[model samples]
Target: MASRTTSWAYRPSLDGLRMLAMYLIILFHTQVPWIQGSFIAVNLFFVLSGYLVTNVVLTEMERTGRLDLGRFYARRVRRLLPAALVAIVGISLVFLLVAPVVRRLGLVGDAQGSLLYVANWRFIAQANDYFAPNVDKSPFLHFWTLSIEEQFYVVFPLLILLLARSSRRGVMVAGLAVVTVASIGAQVYWATADPIHAYYGTDARLYQLSAGALMAVALRTWPVRLPRVGARAVAVGGMALFAVLCFSAVAMSQSNRGFLGTAACLMIVAGLMLDEDQPLAKALSLRPVVYLGQISYSTYLWHWPAILVMGMFLDVGPVTMAALAAVIATGLAAASAELLEQPVRSAKRLNRFRWRVSAVGVACSVLAAVLVVPTVLEREQPPAVASGTGGAAVGKLAAAHSDPLPKDVDWDRVDRDRGTEQTCQVDDLDRCVLHEGSGAHVLLVGDSHARMMTAMFEQLAKKHDFTLSTNIVSGCPWQENLRNTQSSPKRQERCDEARTGWYDTVLPRLDPDLVVVATLPRDHGKWHQRLENRDGSDLGLERSLLRATRDTLDKIEKVADRTLMVQSVATPRSFVPNDCLTSAKDPDDCVVPLTTTNRPSDAYYLAVAADVDAAYTVDLNPAFCPAGPLCSPVVDGMVVWRDNQHLTASFVAHQRAKVWRLIQQTGVLDALDGL
Candidate 1:
């Protein structure tokens, strides 16, 4: 049998396809209303990469009867590493110089992962949901896709080389089919079970790449014999369908993986199958479109960081921000391509020094790691303060409204203790006793807001002779059948499961004497103001919230003798307390107005309490806000909030007396006294 050899040609239609995909991604990041499904562009890129790279490997193997692994790796390193290293080093330096310590803390790890081409796995391991609200976007986030491509570049060639001596085409086709099936299966399973992780996982995304590879193999080994008219029709129809899908109301969510992946693969196949002289192909081959496609990689690399940097200082509307981001990204991409990418790619002498390039990349990664040392050390050390003051110093500082806030008070420590560390609260059915005592058993159930009360509750538990058990999940309310509209689908799934498990399993087993429920009402306000829904429907927010809260309280009443519902605290509008304090010359500058409607109203809780006989509403606003026109970030010389709404552990400790009094006034403690 004779092996077949074919020459590769430049396809302008493919370049046009690349341009379209890149622009869609940019628009998605801009967060325009109609382009919600723009994330599918990534799948399109994967398919294109699979087809082009597979075709290259197959052609080379057929012509030479073997693969040159060294040359292949060297080519990949030269093409990708230089621009990537520049971006990583430049972004890291900017962050260290300008960003707040809190924000800079995680960049080192992100940089290291990106440098090693494993950033996707790093993000997945951190449970960093791409759709999370109000969270700062990582500059290295776009590197995840590049990481996947690089992994494919390394592995796919080796596979082809291994099969070169045997019935290569037959075995390769069979292997690709198995891979495609397994990858798709994994995607479907993970999309249902853990969507956020599934979105970033290599296993879930391999099918799209495999689809392209299969198309390449089929074209080479058993070419499609469609009539010219049939081929043109397929190309036109596929392009039309792809455009419709990209612009349609379909959500780019985890559950829609099959549709998204399949659509992207089909688009790539159509682009490949079409003849160059076809009308659609001629349009795609235009000079401007090809130019845009040429710089697509650089555009993708620079756009995210440009947007993030602009967001850090600019207080502009979304449209304005998006426009500014686009301009900056374009300029950077053009400059990078002309000055850096082109010059490096054309330097033939450097191609022989592959080891040197690898070494340089490694050295840059080491520098990034070194840069994060101070932040790591700072996190490990506890805040310096007077011994046995028992939070009195913070109280005094707040009362004085000290200009230079106490340097000894560790704001980060306050944040860490407030359930950000998973150990502080029970997320699943597993019991987490926050504080053990000989007194009555009191269970706290809510989200991070409830976790914020841990220090105060623990103090109260010790003073009032009560034990504390916490069942809390961050960003999750205690309400049943209600989803966090701002969270990713996977997070919502976990929240629902955890809530169901607590209500069904944990509560019944423990049967505590008192149950306390509290969550940040900011989420509830988002539900109402944005009129958001779990499924993105336009439902009646107020009614839905009331029903969910009522159902949750009803469940709690069944398992506990008494229930206490805490009123949501006053959260400043668009203000981060720590950021305010960091730059304040006078502590008074840190104070924000606390208008009656500044925070989310307790209408849902009030409505739920009116119906549930066992549930009693506890208003702590008087103690925290005290009928004030303005609220201070520092209360009694201690930081009142770690961020906007969450209370600092030190401040909460200072208010232990007020919290204990409120718990006693509920008459549940008096009743527990008899027990």
Candidate 2:
């Protein structure tokens, strides 16, 4: 194959690799049931980026005997910035308009994170679960990959220059190998220690980039002369392995990212070295495939938001959403490339001074962060509160007067739920303390269900003048070796690990005035289809809950004078915030009917509370569901449930006085005092 007129030859087959990587990523985002491991396409993109960037740097250095950072930075700016700026600004504006207020709040910070190329760390701090279906997912989540790539781009040039200047080819090779090996080690270690961090962390992903750079260095500094037969075998085998790694997977997991990265490295090395006339290389260089590859950056930028828009607002199925996302993303990317990207990159003035052009990218990013993101959150007057005189019943207040249905503004603040996340979302409960008080020391343990009652407990502790320390983990119970059906299998290994500090050591050490246990007694409110027994028993949900419950009872029986089993409040089947915000004029729209025809009884919890000695139960069912026929989510101008099952801190604060009276009536605290 003849080289192009530019310093480097135009490798259309490399573009084919880009097209395939993006295709897999888009498929993954659409939640294709069979494409669970397609996220590994990001590794391919990382590796490809490393190879191309290193090629550009080395080619310039070899020709001029010195690489110009200014020109390289400028070229990158003109090549990348225009399309990125347009996508971030345009996509954010659309999301602000269509998404609910609660969903839009994070865009302010995320927009800035995207522009500044630190979205990976931002996402890490937020503890985002990339695969979980239940949590609120940001459309900007995909930007984490871009952040990692950009970080490598900024640092790798200087590092590679130093390695090249070392004057020894062996040192350069060793330096690159060290980076690749160390980063892979980080990926393996973090994949086990904390999967979320492992996925998003820059340290864990450097190997993919370094592997590509190494391949580039090998080919650039020291050319490889391979026989045609040998090169053809590598091309065939590498592409085959790449396909298998992406297609042959069970769950959306990070465990196999290293293997995927290795495969990506193989794919690039094989493609780059193989003759263009080879069948695999010829197919990759097809006009349509190469065009798709050219527009892939913009396509990737638009596809995530497109899928999110389709899924959230359109009520479409995942497959249909995926198709629409692909179509819309492709169309937008084509337009962006034609109207926005090509003009800016090919402009004579931008070609002359890349730094000034690059500044425009920074300016556009700042504009998106400050202007576009804020527009998504409409300024709202705070919700009016009416704490009626002298502990008036919320039921009577709502019945006699109009109760304020939750506004979009209200749910936005409450839904963030930092207390719940900080306290219960950890794999370790030792450090997740909610409060430290001066009076009696009360120990709280369970999961998110327990954290929901935090506001009431906060009120209880403040009024009672006691210190409250909690050991809580979301989705997992206090009992060891149990995991819910919801978590990925790899993550399930750490399910009981959350209780490690508290279960065996903290409870025994604290031995507080009282030990309080609160959790969802039934899994998804169904005993038959709940948690699996990790000990490999087919004990299923009921027995799992039984063992978990018994474990809790035994721990509490030994640790405290008395125990209080806090029952979860009556759960509303109707989606909170969504239903309430939709029918804002009618307070009853979000009501949970407690009629025998609609309500489900807490039979298991009641039974468990009745049988255990030295244990008293506090069920806030009456407080929340005061009127037996219908339980209102909004009572006396306060939103009750933040989501379907969890109570808002504001509502809990409003109900705390009543909850205190209920606890006084239970005589559990008083009984402990007598002990």
Candidate 3:
């Protein structure tokens, strides 16, 4: 037989943890000095949810010898639906009032995804790039995590039912072990091959949930007994580790896929076992922490969007604004939890009827938001155009509004590329082969960053009468030594072999006048160079990479006259293009001004540039962020960084003239003239 809590276990420590978790997330979103990893609170949450929900189900099964699937589901609906509906409705009203058509479309897409409890899948499919701060601007983005948990609930109850049917203890343990292994294997596979998909896929994330379920089963069968002297110390240590991961960005990037996630699960399990009956637990049960836990859901829902709104509309300092907004949200959420959530949740009468009504209303509101909001915004004004040489009317309008969709764009004509290629076009990922006047005067090599340089070089290529050949791959770097080791065993070897062959074969055959090489900066600490080939033969990756750069430069120098290296440009945040769309009513949801800074540092390219023989270096930083240290995003008449990073295509194209001038000045054309 299993035991159930009295429905009031006074587990204040859990509340304390919840408070800590939400605060970590809140602080991280504020872009506070170094709390870069606060996003991991979502992982902590996943673990807690698995343990608590599994414990609840197992307890009920023990009491009745069967699971109440309907009641369990009903309870979930009652707990989750009301506040979600409120948030959806609130955001909808705000969207209708303030958002432009493009913004409204994005918000509607986000809301529709949330209504179906499939926001995670939508994001993964969109490759939404959640780490970009612009994600917070989506009022419904937090729902992705909610979707993951809800989807887990759909499968987890059945697993519990099957487990409970076991008569033999050995059989039960064996079944759990098998499930644990299989789920973890799936997670590992997904994490490496498709990190974004791994992030949101219910199947890939089941392992984290199962870890909690397994812990619950273990606690049920074999209760942990910590030594009296070491018990408190152990609990504190686990909590501290949890805090470090939640607060430190460096730790976050390292732990994002599998290893850190597993460690978070472990810490959660240890904290749960610290015993709710302990004095520390009683202390955690204090009014403030418990109250926060009670409203944790509302807090999570409110915080991200509130930050977005404030950041977008206000000139207040971000730290102060975030702090003020979190406080206001906490107050509002507490009130909602007390007056709305708890009342509807606790009343049995409202439970059945309200759940159905709430669910239906949420669905309708989301639909209306998707279809109605965009239609209204579009009708209010024509789509805005990007400024270019398109004459006064276009220029005046573009200067009036920073959006680049163009009044005549016909989005239907533009290919969203959903079919075979998925998000980005496959053709875009392939190497570009451009015909020139004659001999190869310049070679562009590296990843996408290197490819972007072609925008400038295209003009110079025509001017200098030299041939331009680019042997570039989307994400693949020109480094001959580093293999694609960030995937599964079989896929890793395959990618490694293909990329390695490209360097050894495709590259050597196209020996150009000057080789321009670039790549995204490698974090030196975790940097691993592939030293062995597929057959286990030593390849000496470092030495080979050095040779590749030197040899290419030497060959280009001999073939023509000059070798020029175009320094890598900075990578910006992804949402900078759409940040200004948030309106006045939800001012808190908009992006703050301070986040706009020059693109990331380009110092890493100096090392590679130094190794090049007879090559002059030109960095694109000044051309892009021409204001020097004060350079910020500019497009049309507004900032182009929707998420305080990533240059919008409109901004890139707008700077075409400046980009062309930079190329002509680099003497790359002169090298081509020599050829």
lDDT of 3: 0.56
For model 2, the superposed segments whose C-alpha errors exceed 4 Å read 1-8, 248-253, 375-675
Instruction: List, residue by residue over 18-76, the lDDT tens digit for candidate 2.
Output: 88888788888887767757777888888888888988887888789888877787777
Tens-digit lDDT track of model 1 for 283-319: 7779998888888888888888887766544546656
Q: List the residue pairs that clash in candidate 1.
A: 394-636, 394-637, 394-638, 395-636, 397-637, 398-636, 398-637, 399-636
Q: lDDT of candidate 1?
A: 0.67
- Residue-by-residue lDDT tens digits, candidate 3, 565-610: 5544544333332332332222122222222221111222222333
Pick the winner on lDDT between candidates 2 and 3: 2
**Better lDDT candidate (1, 3):** 1
Please report the TM-score between candidate 1 and the true structure: 0.58
TM-score of each: 0.58, 0.58, 0.56
- Which sequence of candidate numbers ranks them by TM-score, best first? 2, 1, 3
